[model samples]
Target: MIGRYAKLNVYQEIFKSSDFYRVAGGAFLIPVALLIGLMSNTAVIASLSLKELVLIVSVLVNGFPIIMEAVKGVMAKEVNVDELVSIAIIACMLTGNYLEAAVVSAIMVAGALIEEAVSDSARQAIESLVEMTPDTATLLRNGREETVKVETIRKGDMLVVRSGEIIAVDGVIREGATSVDEASITGESIPVNRLEGDDVYAGTTCVDGFIKVEAVRVGEDSTFGKIVQMIQAAEESKTESARIVDEYAKWFTPVILASALLALLFTGDVTRAITVLIVGCPCSFLLAGPVTTVAAISRAATEGVLVKGGGYLENMAKASSLYFDKTGTLTRGEPGVVEILPEGGRSAEDLISMAAAVETGSAHPLATAILRKAGEMSSSIPEAREIVSETGRGVSGMVGEKRVEVVSSDAYGQKGLTTVEVRVDGDVWGCLCMEDEARPMATKAIRDLGAKGINDIRILSGDREPAVKRLADEVGISRWHAGCKPDEKLDLIDTCVGSGLIFVGDGVNDAPALKAADTGIAMGLRGSDVALETADIVLMNDGLEKLPFLVDLSRKMSRTIKINIALSFIINLIAVVLGFAGVLTPILGAITHNIGSILVVALAASLRYSKG
Candidate 1:
């Protein structure tokens, strides 16, 4: 029976695929039929009986689905707007008001169909993400390549991706160099160059050259797959406003039924009671919050901001303070070696070569900087053995018959540059000074946040005080905390929770703080998995400019929601009062109720085009 019902639902959806056109056609014909029924006096073709038959047919065609929905709601023990509308239609029909019943049913169906169309457009944003995954891959096996299903490929399988082909799995480039367009996943419009050993993700396209990628994650475990999953989960999650509206509807439906009964008993007027039922349907109130949320979230997705859920969107709008991590959040996250000072007559080449050798196995931004410097100079760095890293301090390894260590200069109270001391055989040899430049839009983002009324913008960093302070000054942030461990950042987030804090970071150490904040935003392109998982929002392109835009967008969404709710309540109150006063007939009540629903839907749809 369940399977049969599912099949029936599928068929129903298929039949209603062109719902707008069908509903519009039906709505246009309904009033014409009613007018003919009232005005026609012809005996042969335009007879009164023929017009009455047309009205009855129109009412059944438009109102049958609504009646079925009400029945389903009752079976599930839920009193909803459908039941109220069904009652109103039945009352109109019993009172010999076929015109009123037909028009009311047509309007309600048309309104619902329009709302569904708009909501479906918003949902398509997430659906598009799911559709981006490639179905097939060119799998390399036994010295030859053969096309195979992406699902059949396993980890460590080498896949040959040609230029203009979508990458089939998340992997590392094992051969060839290419520029991959990762806009779908990272939201970065520019294609990034990928060489041997560079990571490539699924759903990205190879735009320039052919490359062989060794698959690391396939199917649903890939980064693209995870994003799709998150979006689906987000859509299913309800906001506080939606929950409140649902609770209100639960009690309000019964109250409307009772009020309708009271009107009939006290005034002995069937039309007034039916009007009361029609006006108290709560259609606008039910749609106001969720539709706005869907449109806002869909708009955010199009702009490369992925809000986890409507609840997070609401909290993000309420955030009064913003906290940013220094390394990768405010800065470009790619630091470069500014100066390599050697000691004991060591050449600059020797110093950098040794540093790069020890840093080869590390993925830290500073390590990447040293490795990048070595690559730029085309220097042959010696291999390091028995390498070990000390958390928040340094890395040590044995390089070519000598013990090498790169330690942070924080112990010496150094400021400004991020300096790392190189120790050879237990004596300090030299220090490599690196600088991570502030993001180009960092200042503008901060200023814009201030303009958005978020004055408590602060910086938190695990770097030295001088370096952090310098960056804070550069970015125009007035408050900063330097040399902060992960726990300290978490503490700061906890303290600021009362004021509602937004923490933005992109490192493993930032995960705890991200989870502690009211709303956590992660830089998606370069962020650690832990940080991304913990964050409430992900800036896919790793752009700081999007931060200010997101803040403004959240505020606009909040305002849109408020306006929609106010308009819905006001319309409902006025309609109900007029309904009780006998000023509204059943037909007028249905028109007013549907108008309120249409207005709320229009307001919610406006969020999709809002500038913010």
Candidate 2:
């Protein structure tokens, strides 16, 4: 009997491949043909029968995928929501409520498809990172260089890196010297001079030097590989909200099923009860929240906002307090020479020249900034010998038989600028003060945050108190703390744990603090490996100005989730009432319920197109 019904050959491809056609085609066409035969032969309420057939066909096609999913879940030692829906459909079918079964089944499939599509696209940022890495590297074997797959390159292999070339591995520079532009890595524009023994990272470009490095790590062991691993790990870590939603669904799905069944039993009308059960399928209700969240995440990625997942997206909206690291987060990390106080009636150039000589051959950012400034002053710098860098203090060296010290402001009791005191021959010769300037967008970002109701802003830094206070004043921030070591920052984070806290930072030093916050936002444009990996949210452009926009997006997504949840509940309520009133048959109820589920999912996904 089933073989005769299955003998349709012209539609074989449709049955085998088409998702929509296979489930609905048979049920729909069969009932419609019967109705037409009855009408042509003799009228016998054929129109009402056609309505029931339409309902059944809709439920079966939409609900089949759900049934299949449930079967897979059972086989895999898991509970499947789709399988439960399939069970409900089977019950409707056995009771001769074919219309209800078809509607319920079809709706379940549509909801699952919607959720799958949105979540798949949400992780596109990870794919973007994968595409940015180089696939091959140049390896030197027996002094003969050859291009090889990056994965095949082994440690201790000497790799040649040319000017304008991306560094292929993380290793110490074994030979050659050149200035490397690590803007892609550190977000700093100034090219860093790399001599032998200087560590170089993968993905950074060699701007002006031919260098060879003995690779200590290659392929998946490289720094870039670790970053990819971190990204994957972070994505796997679910936020609290997502967990809540999962728990809610574990109970919500079954509750919805029981309610639909109860409505049918109490009404004592087979058709109306079936309608209630079919309409009460919780597909739309289940999809409402996730769809909106997924859409928000996807849109944020395109705008350079890499939100980790749907759960974080929801939390960011509710962020009431924000704790920011002072140095790189709110201001330009570089400390440039802002003031050159010449003593003994000497010109600014003279002090700068004297200071630059002492500051040269130093690794500190302030030292580099002063040297660069002195070079621009057209002041000749004499060679300094026995150069010494004092830990947490300043640098000293012999400049033409004169002893000079360029100490930080706190070291010399200076209060305003990040001062660099210049002394010649153990006597105070002059002062060259450098200030950490606020970023061009810092003030605007702060103002926008305030306007968005994020009024609690605090600046914590390892810098001196004066510099910290000055920067906070410029940005209109009320709370400021300076001289905070890495541990101190973590302690502060621990205090703020119960309250929502967001730590914004970009350096490797900020790793601990980033990991301790409610949401760690890394300046993606120039974040270090530690920052990128530890931080939950990565701002791709590293534009602190985008903070306001991100907050706005989060709030909008939260609102969307609320709306979806509400709609799901409202639809279920209406379907239950109608079913018990005997206004809908089981088959019709399932079809209507499936339609509602599809509509809810569509509404949730519409968040993708929402304007920020």
Candidate 3:
């Protein structure tokens, strides 16, 4: 009985506090009362008439809030549209135009409420991302499965994700096969097949088969958590246009107040002055940028592109040059052994077996390709001893009785294919010519970027000059820079900064360059965590096809914002002129002002449906 009473009280409190209920009640009550007043012959209720009762009710419900806010703004010495609207309502009431006062106040409150709803609805995409992560995880502990809060699931803990359940953390599948729906994270509608050793991110659903995932990142360190943080930060960071509007409002509000006073002195009519105040409020001006920005950001999120903020989106629209890291940005980053050349009468099997044995524990992309090739050949790799790796050079270890080393051919200044020279006991045994294949979408992405007016395309790579030149030509990029180290990449980015560069890369070495560029886009699937952290944007599914689409979307959003600003200015100007000329009454001025606000919001919301 106590619990039931408490539940009833909670329900009662929620209903009273809800803005929807308040707005809906006011909206419904006013129209129904107006209709009944029109139908009745006398339209009388108690001592007051129907319209008189409406004027009192509307003033109490809507005008009181506007008046209170206006008073606060004045006390703080900050002038705004609310002050102008409040003054207009007061003036109408003083001039025996109570109906005009009610209408103007109602319009102001209703327009603001509706605009808030639209903005809130547009931001639901980011909110949905926050809700995607489940609260509990099925943890595999000591050969038994137990449920625990996701926060308690630490790294290295094994999580058993059953079919039709959301994966609790970012991890690698240790056993079993499953198809995962990563649409919440990557926005890819088609479920991707995940086998042993394949990565599964947090918030993805296991759709087909059960799998045990060894957690790599748990809690707020997961990719989904980082994405949510990025989005929240993005929403808080304002764009250039928003800053301009804020500055303009400081003067615009006072200017409107001055115009109202001047009209009252010259025309000697309070109604004309009130009309001026009503039409001159900067409703459209305030909303022109943020609405478009929010819609564009939301749309980008739905397509698997996480833009850090509206400022980046604004900069991206004006990007003049595009810089790319050749290996992972343009190419697939997965190099495959195309030719295995044997030297000194050594068989191909002997060279591959020795190389694969030494590279068994390495996480390099080339090592992965070699291991895959060895598996395909049905060769059993013997364990290596005393394995040592040199960054950007090679790996050396003892394969059985022989000392084996796999070093880059670039170390000898020889360039044909990107080869790793296999040495046995300090003698060259053979070289494996590996090729990192260019993505099929690379040419199309470049072509589309050029079509969108981004002409200066360049490749800054650490690879040999011949390979870089070949890739640049193949990808239709005219400018190319080869043999760039990590610092050199940063230097190149510095030179392009003045021209607004959009740098795309996926390696740990690319992290510094990514941070230096005007806009950095990281390939989330295979990119280093440092690169993803420093990048301003992330292509979640690592699809280059979306590059051109992003550019197109940015340009479209820029155009839409400009259109909204211009439309708002023109509408406000026309309304101000009509109001000053006594052609627009107080009620008409309020209606026109509300209409302008609605039109601007509607135009900005249209960006949500725009196609690339």
Candidate 4:
């Protein structure tokens, strides 16, 4: 109940924000006051023109916030459109054109209200992510259920999660088996079966399961918590384009002011100068960068793609060449032994048994693949004793009276498959070739990215040539380099031409390259902490499947920003010319000026629904 209220309260806070309320109230009263003032011009209420009286009141009311914002900008050494909008309103009043002042104030107020509404709605769309996990956990202490605050949950606490309940922690399923929906965690909507020893994450709902989980991570340490933190941090980070727009914005007010003064000197008309200020608010122009960036970031977050900043997101559209790490990026990290070849007159079964026994106590991916293949072959796996593992090498142990060893080998296998050499009693017994499966979306992502203008796709991997070549061909990539170390990848990154270079890899071995590339996208699920930290963008759910979406979003945002700039300049140029010719009144100039701003807001807000 408390959690429900908290989420509701947050929803309400958007409407109740200071900007929304002030602008909303003023937007409503401005029109009403105008109608009243127009009627009272003839009635002459209280021996004064009520139209003029109420129009002044409305102007002051709407103009107060604009003035305050302008003052704040001055104090902060920033000049924004508010400063010009405030000037236009003041100049209208000084010229005794109360109706122009009121109309101008009202138009700017309406624009603010519209912008506020769009921004609030975009924020509301992603804020519900916090509600994915329950605030309370049903603790299974001593086999009795006790509901406790999720924050109070600690590692190793056993919790009971039933069907229709959200799992409150990252844990191992200790008992029972049923289906679980990890869409909230992995972005895959399909519910998967969970058995004893299977892992479940917080925010994932139990579709039809009654299970007890032993918590391994609780509260902010869980994956869901980190995603939320990433979203919040992304909100504050800006793109390089946005920063550039802001830096150039300071010159706008000065240039506009100079233009207005020169207009008055040349035309000998005060109204012309005031009209220049009114039309030159530059509200739409200034909104070009920030509005688009906010909406794009918000849209990406809800789709399970967490972009660190607009700068990185923008880089994706500019990237010409995409370099991918073969393991865990193009291919699923789960390797499987595909073929068992015999040597020294030994049977394939003999080689499989020796390899499986030596790797029994190890947790490496290669070891797991060998064990899995042995099980499928229905071969009797012997228990190995005195096991020892070497990093970057293989494991060795005593399998009964026969000595067994599994070591890395340069031996070649079927094209693009990894090979593991097995030894029996210090003699070569044969090798097992393992293949990392290509992701289902790998080919599609490559093709889609090509259409999006990232045509030069390649693979730079530490795997042997055959493994790299096979994955490259499977994924439709033409260029590939095998056995390239991290430093070698950097050498290739520096050679890319055009807009930029984008590198996609698991964060572990590719951290330096990820940091060096123009844009780095990490496969979040299989990526290490180092990869997650180093990459600019993270594909949280299905790795390769999300790439096209990211590229689409970045390209659209860039195009939208350019379109907004062109539209704003064109509209303002025509309006300013008409104002100089006295063909546009301050009231007409005000409407024309803000039309551009409103259009920019709408274009940016549309990005939220682009995927749909």
Best by TM-score: 3
Tell me, what's the RMSD of every candidate?
Answer: 5.6, 7.6, 6.3, 5.6
Q: Candidate 1 lDDT, tens digit per residue, 1-612?
A: 000121101212322666556556666767677577578563444534766667777778777667788888789886647888888888888777777888888877766665555555555566567778888999999999899999999999999999999998999999999999987777677899999999999988999898999999998888788777777777666777888877887887888889889889988998889899888988788777777787777777777778888778788788889999998889887788878888999888888898899999788989999999989888889999999999998999999899999999853235588789999899878888888889889999899889988888999898888888878988899899998988888888888885568999984568788888888899887743664577888887877888877877777777887888889889988888898889998878877887887778777877777563
lDDT of each: 0.80, 0.68, 0.81, 0.78
lDDT of 3: 0.81
- What is the alpha-carbon lDDT of model 4 when measured against the actual structure? 0.78
- Residue 302, candidate 3: Cα error in Å is 1.7
Error of 2 at 7 (Å): 34
- Per-residue lDDT tens digits for candidate 3, residues 388-451, read 9999889999877989999888542344367889999999999888777788899999999999
Clash count per candidate? 0, 21, 0, 5
Candidate 4 residues lying further than 4 Å off, grouped into runs, are 1-51, 120-125, 130-133, 140-144, 218-220, 267-269, 340-367, 370-432, 451-455, 497-499
User: TM-score for every candidate vs. truth?
Assistant: 0.82, 0.72, 0.83, 0.82
* Residue-level lDDT tens digits of model 4 in 385-497: 98888888888888888877888876665476778888878998998998998888899889988988887889998888878878888889999999998788889887873
Instruction: After superposing candidate 1 on the true structure, give the runs of residues whose Cα lies further than 4 Å from its correct spot.
Output: 1-50, 262-267, 332-334, 339-413, 419-432
Residues 560-584, model 2: lDDT tens digits: 7677678777887887787778776
lDDT of 1 at 291: 74
Give the range of the ten consecutive residues with the poorest summed lDDT in model 2.
1-10
Instruction: Score candidate 3 by TM-score against the native.
Output: 0.83
Worst 10 residues of 3 by lDDT: 1-10
